[model samples]
Target chain A: EPEVTQTPSHQVTQMGQEVILRCVPISNHLYFYWYRQILGQKVEFLVSFYNNEISEKSEIFDDQFSVERPDGSNFTLKIRSTKLEDSAMYFCASNQGHFGEAFFGQGTRLTVV
Target chain B: AQSVTQPDIHITVSEGASLELRCNYSYGATPYLFWYVQSPGQGLQLLLKYFSGDTLVQGIKGFEAEFKRSQSSFNLRKPSVHWSDAAEYFCAVGDGGGGADGLTFGKGTHLIIQP
Candidate 1:
């Protein structure tokens, strides 16, 4: 089965540093999303991308966060300034359509020190 | 706004015992419900989804869920859980707008299967 893949299984960055997390979604999927889960917390939606632009985003997706499809098959999330509270497991997901089954990546653990 | 509630923080069940994880969701219109499992150090794996079919939906790994609209719940059940069933189970609800939207996930219930 085709699956989404994320790079840098784990990352540790200093506070205020910029960090970029990369994901390669399933080839045929049309929608991509980024979600985060703080330790012992529920998974929270960050943003959703479609047609090369952001379709929807949550309040947590503030100015410090940006997502891009820098190139075909690559979706990236960049945190302009990482804060200690930014430490969490970030997951990338993709689905073929509105009602299609979504597949998630193993997740990139971001630890902001 | 959509939200999911998984009341149980942790549950321990002996091997070969039956298991049920409770999930309640708050959404308007008809909500699209889903159950996902995450093993240690792994991503969320979809167990099943309920769209507009029968209230009872069967999923992989011999797991099934019943969607009770009256109770606003979608509970996951496994007749016989194995040790490998130990993991975190999350219930999610999606917007029924037929647009590409993110899912609202519950806090998740940690399943501990004792051998």
Candidate 2:
């Protein structure tokens, strides 16, 4: 079965440095999302992208966070300046269309020190 | 606003015993319910979903859920659970608006199976 793939299973970055997380969603998927889960916390939605633009975002998705589908297949999330609280497991998900089941990637563990 | 509530933080069941994980939701409209399972250090996997039609919906891995409109609940159940069923189960509610809206997930319930 085709699945969403994320690169750099784990990453550690300096508190003020930048970090980029990459994901390659299923080829045919039309909707993509980024979610994060702090240790021992619930999964929280950060942002959703469709048609090469942000469709919706949560309060946690502030100006420091940005998502881009640079190429047709590659979706990337960039944090301009990482904070200690940014340490979490970041998940990438994609779906065929509206109300469709979203498939999740293994996740990228981001640890900012 | 849409929200999901999973009451149980953890549950233990012997192998071959029946299992049920409770879930409740607060949504204004008819909510789209889903159940997902995650093993240790893995991504979330969709077990089942309830959009419409039958109140009782069947899903993969011998799991099932009943959507009760009156109770605003969609609880996951299994007739006889196996050791492999040990994992974290999450209940989520979606807007069903057919867009890029994300699902609101509840705090998961950890299922422990004893052999």
Candidate 3:
């Protein structure tokens, strides 16, 4: 089955450094999303993208965070200045259409020191 | 706002025993409910989803869930569970559709299978 794929299975960066997490959604998918789960916490939605732009975002998706569909197949999340609290497992997902079943990537574990 | 609650933090069941995981949802309108399983250090794998129609929905791996509107609950059940079933299960709720459909997930229920 086709699946979403994320790069950098694990990443460790300094607290003040910038980091980029990349994802390649399913080819036919129209909607893409970014979610993060802190250790022992629930998965939280960060942002949703469609038509190459952000469609919705949560309060946790603040100024330090940004997402882009840099290419037709590549979706990325960039953190301008990572904080220690930013450490989490970040997952990328995509679906073909509205409310469709979404497939998730293995996730990128981002650890900020 | 939409939210999901998985009451049990952990559940232990013997292999070959029946299993059930509880989930409750809070949403203003018709909510899209989903069940996902996550093995340690793995990604979220969808088990099943309840959008509309029949309240009882069957999922992969012999798992099924019943959506009870009156109770605002969607509970997952399996007639027989295997040792591989040991994992963390999450219940999630989403909005109608489109790009606005960001899923709200519960804290998750960790399932432990006794051999």
Candidate 1 chain B has its poorest 10 consecutive residues by lDDT at: B94-103
Best by DockQ: 2
Residue-wise C-alpha lDDT for candidate 2, range B1-115, written one tens digit per residue: 8888999999999999999999999999999889989998789899999889999999999999999999999999999999999999999888854358888899899999999
Give the higher-DockQ candidate: 1 or 2.
Answer: 2
Reference-based lDDT, residue A19, model 3: 100
Off by over 4 Å in 1: B96-99
Tens-digit per-residue lDDT, A5-107, candidate 2:
9988999999999999999999999999999999888888899999999999999999999999998999999999999999999999999997688899989
Q: Tens digit of lDDT per residue, candidate 1, span B28-108?
A: 889999999999989999999999979999999999999999999999999999999999999999984224799999999
Error of 1 at A15 (Å): 0.5
Per-model TM-score, in order, reads 0.98, 0.98, 0.98
- Give per-model CA RMSD: 1.0, 1.0, 1.0
**Model 1 chain A weakest 10-residue run by lDDT:** A94-103
- Each candidate's interface RMSD (Å, one decimal) is 1.8, 1.5, 1.6
Q: For candidate 3, lDDT tens digit of each residue in A11-91?
A: 999999999999999999999999999999999999999888898899999999999998798999999999999999999
Off by over 4 Å in 2: none
The CA lDDT at A98 in model 3 is 71
Clashing residue pairs for model 3: none
